[model samples]
Target: MQITTNPEGRTILVGKAIFTPDEVNQGFEQVYKDNVSRVKIPGFRPGKAPFKIFASHVGIESMKEDFTEIAARQALKEMLSGKTIRVVGNPTFEVDSFDGPLNLTIKVSFIPDYELSDPSKITIAVPKFDVTDADLNKAIDNIRGRYASMAPVDRKAKKGDFVYFKWSVITDGRASDRKKEELVEIGMEDFVKDFDKNLVGVKSGDIKIVMAEISSGQEPVEIEINIGEIKERILPNLDDDFAKTLHVENVEALKDIVKNELLEQAKDAKEEYIESMIAKALLEKTNIELPENLIESSVDDEIEKLARDLSKKNITLEMYLEKRGINEEQLRAELTPKATNQAKLDVILDDYSKENSIEASEEEVDQEIEAISNAMKDARRPALNENDEQVRKNLARIIKRRKTVGYLMGKVQLTEK
Candidate 1:
């Protein structure tokens, strides 16, 4: 085997592997022998056919094609061994010849060459804040609200109250009969669009009409909401017994727990905000060139995921395209930006991990796997117990990436919310 590297561009590496005729013939023979037990002919039993007859029946050209594909994969794997190539996309291959001397080319893409300076020197000032007594009181109030009960009120529906209504949406004066009994939780954002604003002053037996736009650039659509009943939330009195119900000895103990919980949550939120700030700062400072092949591969993966999700709902890719009135090219173009952003993030995180020397220990990995297996068992299920070394390595890599993100969070400044 002869290997030569061709520099297509700065970020793309193309490898040309040339295999001798003897090597190609050997591969073909191996494939033929493996398939002999499965291949059937008209005049002979399954595994009793002569080699020459079977080869003639299957056709030498087809055999050569199969042999070349397998050999090319092996050659590319050999060429990529022991290299720290940040491969961002699937390899592209081309066969220059299938006979005499098999010549195959493989293209791999990676992020452009870059370096990171000392991350420890990157000082960040995190804003600090203290949890107040008022915050604790508010948290206690929220906890009481969770155990609150609702009773039908013989009055108007106000903000912070529950309203049951039958609603219908119309687009351009045409009624959309999608579903009849879709329930709307008044204050929840997942309900009707800006439902709080629409339901604030609504009274029982009152019909409130509102107009809302679905997507940006789309025209406003009218919705009719007919309230059936109104309910007011009634909370239990905050006392020592209320605290005991929460497994706390007294009101003071409950307040202390709430205060600690709030402080921890505030710290976590601050850390998250700082991590976002750092990512944006790093992305702006970095000038990395992304290969087109990487973007394309990412888009392909995204589309495949979308297809799988739709399949769960009995929808096919062609059905989605027809419903949306879009061609494959248009869909690809629309998804490119999202895919590019994901690829950029992957490159950035990988570089950051290497610079910070972030790694997951074997013990940490084993703990994670054990935790997953235990969770599965508790759910009365079985875990994926594959003995494949590659599967274990991949899981370890995922855990390490997660840990790397956590490590970066520790290095930045956090401001309490």
Candidate 2:
């Protein structure tokens, strides 16, 4: 095998590999052995047919195709042997010829060579976040709201009230599937075209007509609702009785628990903020060239994730972009920079982890795999095997990168505001 590299930037290596017949002929025998029992040739039983006769039955061109494919990886490996470069993502290959001397066009993308800035010399100041009264109140309200009671009122329906009504859509002259006594929180439930908002100021025993787009690409239809009653949430006071309801000693003990939880949340937020600051500062002074295929793959992943998230809300990414007065091109343009930054961050963290001798142990990987198994037990999915080397390496890479981020965050200098 002979290899020649294209003279270009180090981000990608475009090269040509040519394998001689002697190197490629080693593949046809194995292909024949593997497929001998899988194919049916007339006048001969499976695995009893002569090699030449079976090859002829399967067509020489098809056999050659399989043989060439089987040899391409070996060709690539032979080409990259003794090279100092590390591959970043999956490499691509194109078969140029299947003749006596097989020609292949290979594209190998490697991680870009970059250096990390000195952590001690870095200057990034982030605000010291503190748990405030409002934060504590919000957290406690979250706890109280979960246990709040509802009471009926004779007044008009308000934003936070639960309104029970009978509703049906009128199409042509008929009402279909009329639902009665359906409950919906005024500001919480998402109804068609602010149907809940139109319920504001509604009194009992009143009939309300709302225009809603019930069906896609159809004209608005009139939805008639017969009001029943309005109920409001009454939050319990933070007294000793309320504390007892939550199995706590008293309100003071509850506040202490809440405060401690809030402090933990605030600490996490502060570290994240400082990490973001560090990323920005380092990126400004860092110069790195990522592989084109890696960037494109990352961008595709971002768009796919966005589309998937929107799908959960019964919306398409295209519809979302159209609602925002944008197109796919505009969406991709907006996502490219974020994807680029993320790709750069991965390369940066991997390099830093290596430089600082940071790595994930086998025990750590087993713990993660065990956690994954526990989480997926209910889904009935196959559990990941801890002994799988590839899975272990991938999990190790993730853990190492996170550790690298935490290390950098620890070095960040924060000034209290």
Candidate 3:
């Protein structure tokens, strides 16, 4: 057998597996032996049939097709062994010309070779973050609101008042049967912006309807609220007593706690922002040829993930697409860029891991699993046991990726902004 490869694209390969007449004869003989016992032929008992008779029973063309299939599959499998290319699914086989040299063409799709940009050249300006007095004051205000006392008021509803009412949400002119009581904190636009507009200045027992747009898609949802009761919140003065309520020594201690919390948050946000900038810079600087099939496969995986998330919320993918006024093809098209970027990023990271010798040792992986288990309060910890082979492999891969990214991030020069 003789094999040759031709490139249709950067990631698409057309492999020509030209078999000798002797090899073709051998393939035919093997196929006959494998199927002879199951094949029926007149005037003979199963395996005892003559080659001519068997060929006559199952047409010569069918025999040749079987021979070609077996030989092509074997040749492609042998050619792909030990190759670095990540094949996407199975190859497509086409018989170019069986009459001459038993020629067969196998089209294989794979991720093409890619090289990441030098990590030393990648630089990002990471902002220096600190918790200021304003941040502490903002946090204190939020805490004070949470501890505020609410008491029933006979007067009309006003800003900063808490209103208890029965709400019915209407969508596309259809009223939902899921009526429930809800509370709206007046003047807190984040809680209910439209509610304050229609509920303020209204006395108890007043019924009001408000049209609010939540989602950009579909018609505006109509909110019907039946005012049940009104209450005004009384906030305690921020002093030593308020600090004691939060288990702190005094107001000074509370401020310190809030400042520390804010500082930690600022640090986390800065790290995240730097990582995102690094990813964006890497992608922009590196050039990779992605396989079309791989992108499509990634898109399918994304769609499946979306379906699972929606299923958890008791919604179907079809229902979501329908509500968004899009077809499956359109959704796939919209997700193409995301899938492409993810595929390319995976290839880049894999290459980086290999070049830098980044690896996750067994001890490191075990420690990671233990840390995760300790952090989780629910049954989720058991789902990542080191005893599970797949879980361990996944954990190792994740750790390795993190190590690679961390190495790259360390190499990057950060310009403070």
The residue ranges of model 3 lying beyond 4 angstroms of the native Cα positions read: 1-4, 18-22, 33-66, 77-89, 95-103, 152-182, 186-211, 214-216, 220-230, 237-249, 377-383
lDDT of 1: 0.78
Alpha-carbon shift of residue 126 in model 2 (angstroms): 3.7
Ranking by lDDT: 3, 2, 1
Report the lDDT tens digits of candidate 2 across residue range 127-236.
76788899899999889989999999999999989988888887786665766457878877565545678788998789877787765446788878889988999988
What is the Å distance of residue 31 in model 1 from its true position? 9.4
Clash pairs detected, candidate 1: none
Model 2 alpha-carbon drift over 4 Å, by segment: 1-3, 7-10, 17-83, 98-101, 117-128, 168-181, 192-196, 208-225, 276-286, 296-341, 363-395
lDDT of candidates 1 onward, in order: 0.78, 0.83, 0.84
My TM-score estimates for the predictions, one after another, are 0.69, 0.69, 0.78
Off by over 4 Å in 1: 1-5, 15-60, 63-90, 96-106, 121-130, 152-156, 166-186, 212-228, 300-335, 351-358, 370-395, 406-417
Worst 10 residues of 1 by lDDT: 116-125
Per-residue lDDT tens digits for candidate 1, residues 35-125, read 8789878989887777788789999988887887787788778877887777775778899876588899988877767765344545555
Displacement of the residue 322 alpha carbon in candidate 1, Å: 7.9
Candidate 3 C-alpha lDDT tens digits along 181-223: 8788777765444546777898899877788665555456787
